[model samples]
Structures are given as structure tokens and as C-alpha cells.
Target chain A: MSCWETLADYALRSVGIGERLLPRSDFTICQQVVLIGSGMIWNVYFGVLALCSGFFLATAVALGKASHSVWLRKPSEWFIFIFRGSPLFIQFFFAYFLFLSLKQVAPIFTPFTSAWAGALVVLFLNTAAYSGEIFYGALLSIPKGDTEAADAYGFSGWARFRRIIWPTMLRLAWPAYTNEAIFLFHATTLVFFSGFPAQQQRGDALYYANYFADKTFNPFIPYPILAGYFILLTLLLIGLFGLVNRRLNRHLPRERRAKVRFRPNVIR
Target chain B: MFSYCADPDTLSGLTWLSCYLTTGKHMAFYVSFGTVLLLLAITAPTALLFGFGGAAAARARFFPLRWVGKAYISVVRGVPDIAFFLFFVIALDQGFEWLRHKVKCPDWDQPIRQGSDFVVCDAAKLPLGNAAQWVHETYGFFLAVLTFAIVFGAFAANVLFGAMRAVPHAQLETAEAYGMTQRQTFWRILVPQMWVYALPGLSNLWMVLIKATPLLFLLGVEDIVYWARELGGTKTPRFTDYPHGDWRMWYFLVLLIFYLAFTRVSEVVLDRVMKKLTHGQATAGGEAQRKAA
Candidate 1:
């Protein structure tokens, strides 16, 4: 078939939208590009959803970790430690099995046994823990003068936090959080590999890349395409986060605003 | 191990549990942990060497060498590392075999890529077709270590390159003023001083390396994750003595605890090392130590 037809067939293949069977032989560059690009849909889906939902939980977790009450503090500390300490690959396996066993106990958990719910839940919790730790560090480093100023303005408790504390904490944490978001997107590639079966052969970018590599006995093409897609995604993320970061530090003088620097460290 | 455990089918209660846990497969499962540790032991120094080479090359006077090193270091930044891990394993394997093919059977020119199959002469095969099982396993493990070293070397190179830059330029200037050659300044001063700055990043990389050990399973080595899935699956009484429900959760739970404890211990040790390394250095940690003293 023509490359255009192949593109039309396989463009949304990862989401089970277009093509049914992936190209097995006579693999064209077009097929590899289209299928892997299609697979990126899932990566974006998982990354965006998990990051959006995780942000709120991370804020709560950050506060809980920094809270005065022992009841709130200990669980938050342990939550962050467990998720951050363990490998996400192991977490994915552990969570998949845990969800499976839960399904045995309660039929309600059956849906979670699938990759859709289970892997997303794992990614969400994992990012929350890492981001929560970053946020907690930022919270701790918030200048004492900031809080004193809030007290002086008679902004107490929730008002103090909402108005004075949250923004500053976020401003401090934005760079690390950006790194966490990029890593989280990179990490979405691990779900299918972690034994969460991609229903109907629909999988992420790495999955399709891996498929093409296996089929063609050539690793040169598909993997680089996957990497290119990821590089574009990473740049887009940096740009988006840069905009938020500017807004976070808008009140600061231009000389004082922190420039976003990409320091790629493995947060997992 | 117990005499009563021999006939596992007849045993009940604790005896059955004991025997099951001490099965031959369980021994292999236990040994895989050692494989992980072995991988770490080998990969750590090798990756550091690769990183050092990369950093030095990046700083080389030659433009092409510097560009190559810079590319090696920055490549990891844009892509997911898992992509590298998956790609490099097969690519490196084929690369090795292809090299061997060219050298070992130069005249036997059946194309290496016949459709999807990578056909090499028997002599060119990595382990040789009839090599012992242990040799095959060892070769696979070696390839895994190499792949880990390459990917992580890039990360370490990034850390080390920055650490190299973070070393105050004045220190090198003073060395030069003291009549130290560029080589002497680099070896005696720059290399020694860079560690203090590099420690935090290196420690973080160490934690990352520790977490990455489980990816060994993806390289087709029967590591802990492999055992967990294998042993945790539900088994029928007809199949073996240990007939149980799916216990993968518990197996993974144990893996989780193992990793958590590993990281906790690593963090403590790394902190102490950092303290020791920072003593009397020209850094904030050193200044804090000086004040405390």
C-alpha cells in the first residue's frame, strides 16, 4: 500500500483507532514513523493526565509532609519515601499484581487490573511522590521573612497559605517540577514493558519502536524516531513550564527572576 | 534442606512452606540478587571510567573529539533512558556479531540481514552455537553491563563535565602561575578538586543506577523481577508441591522492601562520604564544617 494509506491506517494505531494488525514485514520508514508517532498519543495521554491529577495531590502531600501534626506528617513522609525510593519498574509490577489481587477480593477493582487504570494510578502516585518531595524542599526553603510578612498583613492560616506561601513554594519548585514532568513523560514508556498488556497491541512509543526493531532486525530507525518525538515533547514541556515559571515570578524584577535551566537528573 | 521436606507432596503446614522456599528455583532466585549486586559493582567503576573519558574528551583541544564527547553527554538529555536501554542491547549484540562475521568469515558473503534474521556463521556467533550455558549467560550479562555503563556514562559525564566547570578557574590559574603545566594542573589540581562538586550529582546518579538494576530483566537476564513473576504465579498442586494462589504482590512487596532498604543505606553512606570529601574543601559544605570545627 501507499505510504499515505499506511499513515492513515497506522497513525492512530496505538489507541486502537485505525490499523488492527501492525506491519509485520516489508516495513517502510513511513510505517515506523506513523506507528511510533501514533504510539506517542498514549505517552501524551498518560503524561498529561497523570501530571495534571498528580499536581493537586503533590501539593497536599507537600503540606502533609511539612505539617505540624504527627498524624498527617508520618503517612506523607512514608508515602513519599516508598514511592521515591523504589524503582518505578518494580512499582509498576507491584501495583499491577496488587490491583490484580484486589480484583480477586472485590469485583470493583476489576477495571483497575487493566493497564488503563492501573498504570495510570501508578504513574500518578509516583509523580506525586517525587513532585511532593520537590515541593516539600521548596516549602522548607521559603524565607521566614515571607511568613512573617504574611503575619504582618494579618493573613492567617488558609489565607496565609493560599496568598503568600503556595505561590512562592511553587516558584521555588518549578524547575525541579519541570524535570519531574519530563521524566514522568519519559517514564510512561515503562507501563507496557511492566507487564501491563497494551490492549489490542496498542502501546506507547517505545513499544512500537521496540516492535519495529524486533521485526526489521534494525534498531537505527525506530528508536531514533521515538527519541525525536520525545525531544520535541521535552522541548514543548520546557516551553510550557517556562511560561508558568514566568507567571510565578512575574512580580520579581527581571534581574531577580530565575532563568529555567534544564538539568536532567533521574528523579525516579 | 530438612529431611522431612524431601517429599513435599506429603508435607503440610510449616514443613511444606519451608521446603517450597528452599526449592532449587528459590536458590536461583536468591542468586539473582547477587547478579544485580555484581552488575552494580562492575558497572559503577566502568561507567565512571567512561564518564571520565567522556568529560576529558569533551575538554580536549581537538574540535572533533570535543564534539563527539559533547554529543555523548547530551544524548541522554533528550530521550528516555529506557529507550537507550532497549535499543543498545540488540544493536550492540548485532554489532559484535557483525564484526566477528567480517573477521571470522570474510568470504562467506550471505548477506547478514536476510529479511529479519541476522545470520552469522557459527564461528561468528557471540557464544558460539555450542558454547556452554554459563558462557551464554555470562555474555548476556556482560552486554547488559556494557549497555548500562554506556547510558549511565553519559549521565555521569554530564555531572562530571559540570563538576569540572564548577571547579574555580582561579585554582587552575594559580596552578599555572606556580609553573604547573596544563596536564599537571588537570591531574593534580582539577581532578582532585572536582569530586567535591561532583559528589552530589554522582550520589544522585548512584541512586539512579541502583533503581535501574531491575531493567536487567528487560535485557533477558533472569533477574529478580523475572523470578517474582515466575514464582508468584498461581500453581496447581498437580504441577508441583507449592500450589498457591497468585502471590506476586507479596513477592513484589519483598522486592520493594529490598530496594527501599538499599536506597536508605546508600543515602546514609553517601552522606557520610560527602562529609568526608567536603572537609577543608573550598565549598559551602566545607565552610560549614570549618565553622563547626
Candidate 2:
């Protein structure tokens, strides 16, 4: 079969679109690329949705962790600790089982058994906890002078937070937040391996890579394709975050602005 | 283990529960936790050594050596670690076998990858193909350790490289002024000073490594996750004396708690070590210690 024909058949295979069954017997390089590329769609979807939603929740969590009220502070602290302390793999397993039990109690929530709902829920909470810690550090390191300036201008509570505290916290946290973004995207690969079942073979990049490897017993082709897609994804994330970092640091002088660089270590 | 517990059907209440939890499979479950700790104990120092070598090479004067060092760190960091875990195992296994085939059977003239069958000469097989099951299991564990070390070594190299640079330039210059050789200055001043900066990143990496131990299950190791699924699945009465309902959820919850506790203990230990390392340094932690003392 021609490359275009192969591409057409497998392009949407990961989402259960074109082919009802995956290729059996013979596997080709084109099929590996198309299927793994299709699988990357799930990775991007999970990462983007989780990070977008986790950003706001992480902000709330950071604020809660820093709140004067113990009621607010304690829960956030434990949430961050529980999620951050455990592996994402275990969290995926624990969440799937917990969700399974919850569905047993309430049968209407059966959709939560699927990867889309179950894995996303775990990723959301996990990223929130990690980003919450980063934001917490940033909150603590926020310049005291800014808060004093806000107070002198009669700013208090929401006004102070909106105008001064929040922005400063974000600015301080942006670099670590970039790291969180990269790691969270990488963690998306763990979704299929955990308790969450990929319905109809609709799995992530690593999932499809595993599928191809199982069929052919050849790791040489499929694994590298997955790696290439992820490296590209990481580069894309870095570029996007760099743009945002520029915007966040826009008010500072050129010399004062911090240039965000890849640290290559995931801080759990 | 008690007399009443011998016949699980006859027993009720806590005796049955105690006996059930102490079954052979459950004993394996308990042992798997030790496997995780053992992996961490072995991988940490090995990764650190790899990191040290990589960092040194990256800073080497030779261009090719520097490029190789940089490539090692970047390649690992660029891809998802789980991919490396899956890819390296098979690749390394095949690589060793291919080498063995070349050395053992040079006259044997057949392609290894003939129609998806990686058939090396029988003598060239890793563990010799007919080795005991334990030998195979040990070989797998060794591979998992190698994969973990290679992946984590890159992160450690990145941290150590940063930490080495963070060591104040004046300290090395001062050692030079005192007539110390480059190597002596590096040994006495640079390495010592780098530790304080390296501690934070290394501790963070250590926690990540701890959490990553569960991936051993994916690598086909009989880890806690493996035992959890094995023992927690719905067991029919025909299969066992003590059958149970679907309790995988509870089993996973237990695993989660185990990891959380492990991570917390590690954090405490690492925090103490950080404090010890920071003593007499000019950092914030050192100054706080100085004032308290």
C-alpha cells in the first residue's frame, strides 16, 4: 500500500476513527509514525487540559496554603503533600480504583471509568499539587516591599492580591512553572499504564508505541517515533512558556529580567 | 498460622483476617517493598557516579568528549523517561545477545532478525536461555537498575553541572593563590562548595527516583503493584482456600499510603542531610544555623 493510503487509514486510528482493528501481522515505519502521531493527540489533550485547569487551581491552592486561616491552609497543605509525595503511576491506579468504587456507589458516573475522565482527573490533581508547591515557594519569596506599597496605597485583601500579590507570585513562580509544565506533559505517558483502561485501544503515545512493539517485537522503530513526537512537544512547550515568561517579566528592566532556561530535572 | 487459621472455612473474625494477610502471596507483597528500597539504595550512588563522570566530561577541554557528555544529558532529558525504560530494556538485551553471538558463533551465518524472530545461537543467549527462572529474574532486575541509573544519571548530571558552576570562582582562585594544583583546588574547594548547591536539586531528584520505583511493575518486576493486582483480583473458591471479592482498590490504597510514607521519611532524612551539608556555608540555611548555635 502507498504511504498516503497507509496514513489515511491510521491517521485517526488512535481515537477509534478509521480502523476498527489495529494492523496485525505486518507493521511498517509509516504505520508506526501515523499511529504514534495519532496517539500524541491524546498526550497533548491530557497535558493541555490538565495544565490549563491546574493553573487556576494551583493559584487557589497556593493562596490557600499561605492563608492566615488554618482551615484553609491545612487542607491545601495535605492535598499538595499527598499528590506530590506519591508517584503519578500510583495516583493513576489509586484514582482509577477509587473512581471505580465511586461508580459502584453511583452507577450514573460510569463514564469516569474511561481514560478521558479518569486519567484527566488524576493529572489535574497531580499537576495542581506540584504547581501549588512551586507557587507556594514563589508566594513566600514575593518581595515584601510590594505588599507594603500596596498597603500604603490603601490596598487590602482582594485589591492587594489582584494588583500586587498575585502577579508577583506568578512572576516568581514562572520558571518553576515551566518545569512543572514539561514534567506534567511527560507524566501524561503514564496514564495508560495505570489502572485506567484505554477504551478500544484509544490510548496515548506510549500506549500506541507499546502496541506496535508488542505486534512486531521490535522496539527500534516505534519507540524512537514516540520520542521524536515528545521532544517536539517539549520544545513547543518551552517556546510557549518562554513567550509567557517574557510577558510576565515585561515590567522589569532588561538586565533585571530572568531568562528562563531548561533545568532538565523534574522536581517532584 | 494458628490451628484455627489452618481451616479458613471454620474460622471467623480476626483469626481469619490475620491468616489471610499472612499467606504466601502476601509475604511476597511485603518483600516487594524491600525490592523498591533496594533499587533506590543501589541506583542512587550509581547514578551519582554516572552524573559526576558526565559533568566532568562536559567540562573537559576536548570538544568531542564535551559533545558526548552534553548529548548524554540532553538525550535522556529530551524524551519521556518511560519510553527509555521500555526501549532500553529490549535494545540492551538484543545488543548483549548480538555481541555474544558474534564472539561465540562467528561461523554461524544467519540474520538475527529473520521474520520478527531474534534467534541468536543458543549458547549466545543471555543467561544461556535454559538458566533457572531466578537467573532470568535477576537479569531483569539488573536491566531495570541499569535503565533507572542511566535515566536518573542525566538529571543528576544536569544538577551537578549547575552546582559545579555555582561554586564561587574566588574560592578556586584563592586555592590557586595558595599554590594548590588545579586538581587539588578542585578536590578541596570546588567539590566541597558544590555539595551545598547540589543538595537541593539532588534531594528533589531523590524524591522523584523514589516515586519512580513503581515503574518496575511495568518492567515486569513483581513489585507492590504486581502483587496488588495478583492478590486483590476476584479469587474464586476453586482457585484458593480463602477467596475474596474485588479488593484491588483497597490494595492500591495501601500501596499509595506506603509510597507517601516512604516519600515523607526520605524528605525528612534528606532535609537533615541538607542541614548538615549547609553548616558553615554562606547560604541562608548556614546563617540560620550559625545564629541558632
Candidate 3:
């Protein structure tokens, strides 16, 4: 089949659209590209959803870590320590089987057995922990004068945090948080590789890359294509986060504004 | 194993538990944890060597060499490292055998790529296709070690390169004024100062490297993750004496705790080492030390 037809057939194939069965034999470059690109939809889905939902939890975690009460502080500290200390690969494995047992226990958790809900939950917690640590560091490093100024303006408690504290904490944390985000997107590729079965082979970019590599016994093509897609995604993420970085540091002079440098954390 | 472990079917309760825990397979499971530690031990220094080479090359004055170094350093940054791990294992395997094919069997090649198969001659196969089982496992472990070094080396190179630049220009000027040659300046002045700056990042990378040891399972080595999955799966009476329900969740929980404990201990130890290293230095940590004194 033509590249256009292959694209049409398999473009949304990862989500179980268009193509019912993946091309099994005589794999074409077009088929590999289309199917792998289709697989990217899942990566974006998991990355975007997890990062969005994790952001709030991360903020809460950051605050909890900084809270004066041991009740709040101890759990937050342990939460960050437990998640951040373990390899995310192990977390996915542990969570998948945990969810599997949970499904056996109750019908309400049946959805957790599948990759979508189950893997998403794992990624959400993992990123929140990593990002939460970043934010807590930033929260501690927030300029004392800024809070004093807020107090002078009669900004107390929630108003003080919402108005004066959060923006500055975010500003301090944005560079590292951008790195966290890129890593989180990269981490999404592990979901299918983890215990969560790709129901109907609806897997992520690395999943399809792995499929072609297995089928063709050629690691060159599909893996590079996956890499190219990810590099593009990484650059796009940098650009997107750079915009936010600018907004965070807008009041600062040009030279003083922090640049969103891509210091990729190799593993988490 | 114990003498009683020979007949696990007859055993029950704590006796059965002790026997099962001491089984050969369980022995392998325990050894796999050592495999992780071994991988870390080998890979850490080798990757630092790779990173040092990369950073030095990146600092090279020649344009082409600098470009190559820069490329080496950035290659692992954007891609998912799992993809790199997956690719490099097969890629390096094929690469080695293909090189062996070219060297050993120069004249007898129809084609290496026969549709879907990557067929090098029998003699050209890694571990020679007839080598002992241990050789194959060692070769697989070697490839995994190489892949980890390559990926983590790039990250380290980035850290070291930044650390290299963070070494002030005045340090070099002072060395020049002291009549030191460029090589002498680099070795004596630049390199010594570079470590102080590199320590923080290198330590971070060390933590990451520890976590990444589990990916050895994906490389097909019988690491802890591999063993956990193997041992934790449901076993019928036909398979072995330890017939039980699926306990992969508990197995993984053990793996999780292993990592958490490992990281916690590393953090505590590394922090002390950092303090000792900074005891009299000009760095902020040292300044704080001086203030406390």
C-alpha cells in the first residue's frame, strides 16, 4: 500500500482507530513510521494528562513538606522519599500488580488493570513526587523579603501564599520543573513496558518501536524514528515551558531572567 | 540449600519457608541483587572514564573533534533512555558480529541482511555461538554495561563540561602567569578545580545510575527484576514444590524497598563524603563549615 494509505490506515491505530490489525509481515518503512507515529498519540495522552493533574498535587506536596506541623510534614516527606528513591520502572511493576489485586477485590477498580488508568496513576504520583521535591526546594529558597513585603501589605495565610509566595516559588522552580516535565514525557514510554498490558496493542511510541524492532530484527530504523519524534517533543516542551518561564520571570530584567536549560535527568 | 530442601513437597510451615528461601532459584534471585551492585561497581567508573573523554574532547580546540564531542554529549538528552538501552543492546550486538564477520569471513558473504534475519557466519557470532552459558550471560552483561556507560556518560559529560566552564577564566590566566604550560595548567589547575564543581552533578548522576541498574532486565540479564518476575509467578505442583498463587506484587514490593533503602543509604553516605571533601575548600559548604567553627 501507498504511504498515504498506510498513514490513513494506521495513523490513529494506537488508540484502536482505522487499523484493526497491525501489519505483521513484509513491514514497510511507511508502515513503521505511521504505526509508530500513531503510537505517539498515547505518549502525548499520558504525558499531558499526567503532567496536568500532577501539577496541583505537586504544589500540595511542596506545601506539605514545608508545613510546620509534623502531621503534614512527615507524610509529605515520606511520600517524596519513597517515590523519588525507587526506580520508576519498579514502581510501575509494583503498581500494576497492586492494581491487578485491587481489581480482583472490587469491580470499581477494574479500569486500573488496563494501561490507561493504571499507568496514568503511577506516572501522576511519580512526577508529583519528583516535581514536589523541586517545588519544596523552591519554596524554601523563596526570598524572605518577598514574604515580609506580603506581610507588610496585610497579605495573610492563603492570600499571602496565593498572591506573594506561589508565583515566586514557581519562578524559582521553573527551570528544574521544565526538566521534570521532559523526563515525565520520556517516562510515559515505560507504561506499556511495565506490567500494565497494552489492551489491543494500544501502546506508546517505545512500544511500537519495540514491536518493529522485534519483527524486522532491525533496531536502526524504528528506534531512530522514535528518537526523532521524542526530540521534537522535547524541543516543543522546552518551547512551551520557555513561554511559561518568561511569564514567571517577566518582571525581572532580561539578563537576570532564568533560561529554561535542557539538563535531562537520565533516570528517575 | 538445606538437606531437607531436597523434598519440599513433604515440608510445611516455617520448615517449608526456610527450604523455599534457600532453593537454587532463590539463590539466583539473591545473586541477582549482587548483579545489580556489580553492574553499578563496573559501570560507574567506566562511565566516568567515558564522560571524562567526552568532556576533554568537547574542550578540544579542533572544530571537528569538538563537534564530535558535543554530539556525543547531547545524543542521550532528548530521547527516552529506555529507547537508547533497547536500541544499543541489539545494535551493539549486531555491530560486533558484523565487524567480526568482516574480519573473519571476508570472502563468504552473500548478505548479512536476509529479509528479517541478521545472519553473520557461525564463526562471527558473539561468544562464538557455541560458548558456555556463562559466556553468553557475560556477553549480555557486557553489552548492558556498555550501553549504560554510553548513555550516562553523555549526562556526565554535560555536567563535566558545565563544570569545566564554571572553572573561572582567571584560574587559567594565573596559571599562565606562573609559566605553566597548557597541559600543566589543565592537569594541575583546571582539572583539580573542575572536580569541586563536578562533584554535585556527578553525585546526582551516581544516584541515577543506581536506579538504572534495574534496566538490565530489559537487556535480558537475570537481574533482580527478572528474578522477581520469575519467582513470583504462580507455580503449580508440576513445576516445583513451592506451589503458590501469583505474588508478583509482593516480589515487586520487595524490589521497591530494596531500591528505596539503597538510595537512602547512598544519600546519607554521599552527604558525609561531600562534607569531608568540602571541609577546607572555598566552596559554600566549606564556608559554612568555617562559620560553624
| Candidate 1 true-interface contact recovery | 0.76
TM-scores of the candidates are: 0.98, 0.97, 0.97
Candidate 2 ranges with C-alpha deviation above 4 Å? A266-268
Q: Residue B207 in candidate 2 has what lDDT?
A: 92
Q: Candidate 3: which docking quality band?
A: high
- Of candidate 1 chain B, the 10-residue stretch with the lowest lDDT total is B73-82
Any residue pairs clashing in model 3, and if so which?
none
Candidates in order have lDDT scores of 0.92, 0.88, 0.91
Looking at model 1, residue A218 earns an lDDT score of 88
For lDDT, candidate 2 versus 3, the one ahead is 3
Q: Residues A101-175, candidate 1: write the lDDT tens digits.
A: 988889999888888889999999999999999999999999999999899989998989999999999999999
Docking class of 1: medium
lDDT for each residue of candidate 3 in A1-268, tens digit (9 for 90 to 100)? 8999999999998988897989988999889888888999989999999999999999999999999999999999999999999999999999988888887879899988888899999999999999999999999999899999899989998889898899999999999999999999988888888788988888888999999999889999999999989989999999999999999899999999988888777768
Indicate the fraction of true inter-chain contacts that candidate 2 also forms: 0.70
lDDT of residue B4 for candidate 2: 67
- The per-candidate count of clashes, in order, stands at 0, 0, 0
Candidate 1 Cα outliers beyond 4 Å, as residue runs: none
How big an interface RMSD has model 2? Answer: 1.8
